[model samples]
Target: MSGEQAGWALELYQRSVLKQQKFAGIQSLLGDTAGKRCLDIGADNGVVSLLLRRGGGDWSSADLAPEAVASIRSLVGGRVERIDGGPTPFADREFDLVVVVDFLEHIPDDRGFAAELGRILKPGGRLIVNVPREPRWSLVWPLRHAIGLTDQWHGHLRPGYREDSLAALLKPWFEVTAARTYCKTFSELLDTALNFGYVIKKRGQGEGGSTAKGTVVTQADWQKGGAGAMKALYPAMRAWTALDGLLPFFKGYRLIVQATRGSD
Candidate 1:
């Protein structure tokens, strides 16, 4: 494929991925309980805040960074809260529902974090989670230089997990309610691409990998070869894309798990 085609393919893939990854099944499971307090970890740009508010869930947002808290507050006016220090900062049983989306892989000891999530959820409260699949698949870092996202993968300590593995972690605290694999696809020039998917897992782990943190990367001080580099990457990109189809036997794109807090 030509560089221009490769660029277009990548763009198409991104749109497909975003659509799959951002579903609000969490709100549905929360049902009419949305007006209760919600806690969304890794609230990033606070997009989920809007989702919760729209869903009729009154919730506060939490992030690991004060700067992020400030930015979110500026954007939404006192809706976001800053949690200073370490994993799992909230008091016990403080929330009705927690949502953690695509944020678990960054922490090394994910099980410990899940345990903490369980501690903070009220009895029968729900936790919604989505993370990378077991096979650890990702598009070729994608124009890293153009986007200035050097070391983008560093944030993921073990970004991939299987359904059974995830189940084992949460079984102690939550009962499995619903579980499934979900992906969204987009077609471009007769080729269909998947952007990202959720291994939809839920429970009262109160959104363990659910919160947000603050970090930044400045533009790289050097110019990327742009179209030239893409030209060179084409051969590898094609091979990688081809391999993605064949590797399902070993691991999938992600694992989805859903569980609810066990009645104590």
Candidate 2:
């Protein structure tokens, strides 16, 4: 790719990483966002807010970066808001749907972020979240470091929330209704690779944690995907996508949960 084309490609990739199949799943599962007050917090590019708007939700967005907010305005014709500091400047229980998307990982106090989710959501409101799962390819750290790409491995990963640990943290403020794992399942040895996942809503006072442990990919599994191996593994690739909704550990990613506010 030429210089301009390469820049364009990188832009597309960033957008893809931000708003891809995961958001699509959220949209499909949540149904028409019509008539719902939607807030896309930490909405870097406001893609999700745009999506919420396209889905007929009353959409507004907030981002910490002025450039990001400006970018959102450029794309969707203005009306995007800039969040002051790290605080969410919204009245309590103002929105019906609050999307945190990839924001949680970046926030140091993830619990405070979760509490903000609870605070902003109306009673029985829903939060749509997407976060990176544990990186199974830890063995590649050396190579990635050599290439200047491993400055901070899982730089945003919070302590005590792989799969099971996450459940404990959020359950106190929300009740998990629809919970399942979504991962990229392919390759030869490991059926799935858990890069990232999502969470949905079910109502609850948000307490209780699960003792469940999830499978993690090993270095041996990464070694199995040698040159020319990914193409050879294509046929089975479709199978993992088919099986993602059912089998959590076997997929490349971890869990996607749906939780709602508690009735109490």
Candidate 3:
């Protein structure tokens, strides 16, 4: 059973335009998992994991970081595993679906990670990946950098992946079906500004040891009227994101890629 404070991540989800857009893109592409065995790996804050569980899958979540595992535990109860950074403990072809979220770039051996993902998935199984997309040039790069969102801060080994490059990485085990990018300039910049404020506020208090760092909300953050204020303002934030539709020319920072595992 989830603790009383699982709303920590849910609160962050409500306040984050980027996370909302990412979740929307992922849900639209990921079909029903009812009665299927699903693995959600590498979730930092585990909001998606909680949502997936609610959506009715035989869901298990895991993370390589202990901080992440504890954070996930607060949301999804006993279903999450804390794994070492190597081949996972799951049996071969054990999962009908696998969703990899935001941890690929943090890995040094992404090829091996891809291989492991393939090994755990049954043939014809679906895989969903969410990542920060690499762009040729981003106008908001300086803003993000100024806010201390560098690769190290993000725990990223590399910046991120392009669709083609990421597809090639998964080529040995799966076929890519679809790719979509979101969080365009307007929304992304807004996200960055919010993160800047969050970082500032985080400095004022002792952070949760079980919680992963970098812009995620914690139980402590839920204690005040601030969350209510943000939830009430989220609609306006969503409306401001509508400006993204006006600039189709600029690629967004977030990317979701879907693939299917093969029997080999």
Error of 2 at 53 (Å): 1.5
TM-score of 3: 0.91
Which whole-number lDDT from 0 to 100 does residue 138 have in model 3? 81
Which residue segments of model 2 deviate by more than 4 Å? 1-19, 84-86, 135-146, 151-161, 183-249
lDDT of 2 by residue, 1-264 (tens): 134423332333233322355665566557657888987765554445555666787777876546556655655565577763355777788888776554566555777767777877888888766555555454433443453232133334442135555666677888766654444532211321322110000013142211111111112222334213444544455554455446445533444566787654
TM-score of each: 0.59, 0.62, 0.91
For residue 57, give model 1's deviation from the true position in Å: 2.6
Residue-level lDDT of model 1, residues 93-212, one tens digit each, is 888888776556666567777877788888888887766655344343343213333224224556456677777777688776766553311111011111110101112323222223
Candidate 1: stretches off by over 4 Å = 1-21, 25-28, 65-68, 83-87, 136-154, 184-256
Candidate 1: global Cα-lDDT?
0.50
Kindly indicate the candidate among 2 and 3 with the higher TM-score.
3
The model with the greater lDDT, 1 or 3, is 3
In order, candidate lDDTs are: 0.50, 0.51, 0.80
Count clashing residue pairs per candidate: 19, 29, 0
